[model samples]
Target: MLGAGAVLGLLAACSGGGSGAAPRPTSSGDGEIIVASGLDVTGSDGVRQQLIHAWNLTAEGRKHPARLLELPGGADEQRSQLLGALQSGSSQYDVVNLDGTWIPEFAEAGLITPLDPQVKADPDVIPSVAATARWKGHTYALPFNSDVGLLYYRPDYLKAAGFDPDSYPAAGMKWSGLQTMIRQLDTVHAEGALPGYQRGWTSQLAAYEGLTVNTIEAFASAGVHLTDPDGHYTADPAQLKTGLDELRDRAGSEYTLRGALSSYEAQSLSDFTAGRTAFLRHWPYAYRLLPQSLGAGQWAVAPLPGDAVLGGQDLAVSAASPRAAYALELAKFLTDPKSESCLLQAGFAATRDSAYRTPPPACPYVSPPAGSSPSASPSASSGETSTMPRDGQNRPLYASGTLRTALTSAVQRPRTPYYGAFTQALQSVVHGWLADPDPPDTDQVARRLDTALRRALAGR
Candidate 1:
């Protein structure tokens, strides 16, 4: 696995460069509230903290200056701690930055307060992202930063394999057609046609949220969802079965990353950016790290053959917050138009449509001049990331406008209050056959998944 530390300087440059120092912690004085998230604020998560510092210097009116409350880095740990606090109706924290998928879970439990009149969806915000901020018709959170999965491929390998770099992103192809492409590419990779290219494609398949994310995307492309808009379980066994078979096949490609069974986005990206794989399925953040790792034009992002799964975070006010009104103001400060621009410049895919209207000044990736160090001491603040590196000067359609369009067409993961349970059930069902040599019994697997989802949603 690539140590995340190896890429901090690159991530820093993508955000228009940052000082290596973590922001000195501020005292939580009378008028200041705390923004608690699973971010280090001084390390990989530095970008957001710097933004907070910038916001503090100008804060006035109902908005109180905010401080950072460091939380455990593990996503689950943060969720657990926040839930415990909310369940106890404590207001030690005011604003909570949550994974987009958690909005339903937190809001339904009354753990997070809705934005209400303080903030609401706007025409400038991406519709899909805006939708994630609302639950039961209330705007429960504000989209802070956003993400969608993308297909990163090497044109050199594709051209060597006799595939046209021109005829891609191949967004028109469904997963079935993508499977054929993968097989052909797999054959080419095994022949050593592209030096150091050891795999056809690599994606997140570990037994964690990433697996569920990939599963939902597969099901969406297959035209089945775990539930309908009303939140009822409505998975189609036949489609799900077919989708599982495809995942099994993608996982079986011989050239697939050898470390795949244990890999997540970081490992997968390290392989691709390191020139070990022909393709990688990862979020936009990879763009910021690639330029530092690869030579110019070495890699590019394209729309996945299927609907990309949306990934990102949102901000919600804690219901128990004594400073709910001011916290709401703080949320606005962090997500407002100006802040959104700062996020984009820093490499976070901002949620507002306006941010994308004018392309960000920096390309997602910029190779620093030769001999420039690839790292800097990053503040532990937060990393709001984006994809698409400027090749020192230009961005192709795939890296810029095309991606914003894809976000409009992207598929969201299931919007259920029991998202945690649903994701676990999904991980179990899919990973069971991911490494199996023999073809899976699709019917049996589908039955198991359906039951798992049912039990999960039913609180089993």
Candidate 2:
């Protein structure tokens, strides 16, 4: 499914140089400040409710009480609906949540307004995460929780294969080193030494924006930047080939789970939760919902073998909203140190620096909202992937500096107005390479990507 990344395809990008740029419905939403967010499936609804509840207690909060406008889940549909609202000049939504990759397209289109530069810079957020809000010299959005890929592994499985479980997640490991580990675990599982573990490794590699992210991380880890120093579209074919080659290795039969072709972030987590996979590449939210059965010693969160692509959602004032001022204030409230701390402890990672440094509050997580329905994309909950996970919101996550460090070291996907098309092109070509009977001659594929990216930039 195309998403906020795909929304880039829905709009016309730059002609020459310059730019532009979920919620559930509530009865109280009418006439109140409306925040449209992709539902947090990891079940952070209580955090949302309490934040709004807390806001209403203040004098200003009562005057401009914020409520949710749940958008249809998944990137593509959410983007389409949001674009339709903004383009149609609807005043229905005051605050809008955004995927960082969609910043260029919306900014270029003038569909969202730039926010306060000071507030954008106020938080001690990870630099890369902070960068998503400031594009082309202006800050257009507020940095909410940031996502960088972490390698979640079954410590028991690794130890069974004669590997040190604790050594892996503390720092970045080489991709080649990970492959060695995967192969060892694959063999171990095959020999029935790890009975419940059915797969060696799994990740968000399906033909969607997630593939684009995974592919970009591969390239970025190898020092390939899709944009040049000036932030213009440029890619070295050889470098791209190197990255794609690594992806091909991971997609190999030995490394992939049985339903690997269909896996996204949620599915990967589900498999991991069921003890079907030994290693998982997912975001921080997974920790909140992780089964108690696995427990702390059984799993660990560490940096990906290479740097990962940054993710998570952001908040913006819709250019079409009538209450831009109110919306901005509401956004500030939600992303403020206190609210962000609440979010951090609740499962959705926080974008505020203070949230990470401070101790988590007691009982930060809340129970699932009454009558919460499952999304069409089963397991699709994270706003980073799709929405938050629906299954594991109450699960507790232990704090470590690993995730914070991952955010600092993570790479971002290409910053282009045509991110949707660029992502589609990447997903298509990479999927083709993975599906090929013969290993792809990635040099040829690189040339194709070069053409594809140029065309996307040209808005063709």
Candidate 3:
């Protein structure tokens, strides 16, 4: 199978723009920064409109005056449009948003230029946010909306488990650990104290981005790094075995809390917000809907369990553009703390340190109900709550800040060219393993995986 990066790069190379020719846009323009962004505004058109409004306001007074245009259509269509934009020598759009994982592919294809030092030197921008834009030691796209998966829990349920609300493992916590906790919670829920209480954990596990990202987190925490230190796939059999075994066990276990294996099916997020799950593994965007879905105080949020990998997107400028500087300036503005907050307010998590550190009033909680004015701060302001693995209710019974610290220290998924292929192959193997009660010959599995990795790495 073709590795994700190679697939993209190959597409880029074959797209007729490999020689750095800028696509000629049917509509030519100067002075305005056209942004090709992908924020689906179909259902919540009002919210989508609000985001555009907020962005327009924040982008005003910037060094360059920008005209942000929403790029319509699906991802494949969008990708094609972006390529067409770059190849046609058209300056229709200066900035474009990319999935966080797509940064490498975009950069490798030379579709975007790296950020200039002048923008990095700006005091208004956060370095952490700026750093996310960098590709190959150069900044390409500013991190616009930043999101990391977190564990959502009910404090009431954890209290029933006899475990202190605090003291949940921050980093290095394993999915196996969650399995144990869920079993305990199920036992308590069956005791009839918590009637509506279901399984312990819920997640989107239908072979999509969420599944791949979650699996990476588990493997990373299990000490099975996806890519070698040199940023390439490794043939570490023991590491792979341990990681696969843990995943298979978790996947096969029927007692996984509701939040553990809930298929997104049709309306997973809607279902999640409806409070059908006890614990959820999801991105920060879900924060906006909790109040409406689970009711206030019923749901709580914390950083993802040990070694949870970060899943989000980044922004990049087209390298072949005539106005590279202008494109980057627009990119910088889009990822600016103020801009990030706007995106966050619009329901995405801002990747900037400032936005994350000095969260808007809605930081770590639901925003005011839909169509309501945004809050300046969280309503229930408590002291720095423990971020460690919490018992249940999002309350921090553990030491303050310990959870986030642990999570940050935990290993992240492999940032490699072959990440997609590796993950798909692993998923197949792991799924089969989970389905079979009698453990198949793991040796055969390993051989197949090893062969698959070698083939993917070789660009077959």
What's the true lDDT of residue 396 in model 3?
26
Candidate 1 weakest lDDT stretch, 10 residues: 16-25
User: Which lDDT value does model 2 have at 207?
Assistant: 85
* Poorest lDDT segment (10 consecutive residues) of candidate 2: 12-21
TM-score of every model versus the real structure: 0.83, 0.83, 0.71
**Model 3 residue 128 lDDT score:** 38
| CA lDDT of every candidate | 0.68, 0.69, 0.52
How would you encode candidate 2's per-residue C-alpha lDDT over 93-187 as one tens digit per residue? Answer: 88888888888888888988876543536646667888887778888888766777878888888899988786764465688888788788878
**Candidate 1 residue-wise lDDT, 1-460, digit = tens:** 1134433332332322111221122322356677888753124535576555554544242246778787874666788898898899887888898888889999989899766654544788889988888888888988888888888888776777787877764756665665566667778766766667666778877787777777777777767777765466876677678777656656676536777766877788888877777778887767666765776557777788777899888988887777776666667767776566556655567788766666433322222222234542231332322233432223323434656876888888878788888787778777776756674578888877778888887667
Model 1: per-residue Cα lDDT at residue 330: 66
Q: Which regions of candidate 1 fall more than 4 Å away from where they truly are?
A: 1-31, 40-45, 59-63, 190-192, 359-388, 391-399, 437-440
Q: Comparing candidate 2 with candidate 3, which one achieves the higher lDDT?
A: 2
Query: Candidate 3, after superposition: displacement of residue 282 in Å?
Result: 1.1
Q: Which candidate wins on lDDT?
A: 2
Ranking by TM-score: 2, 1, 3
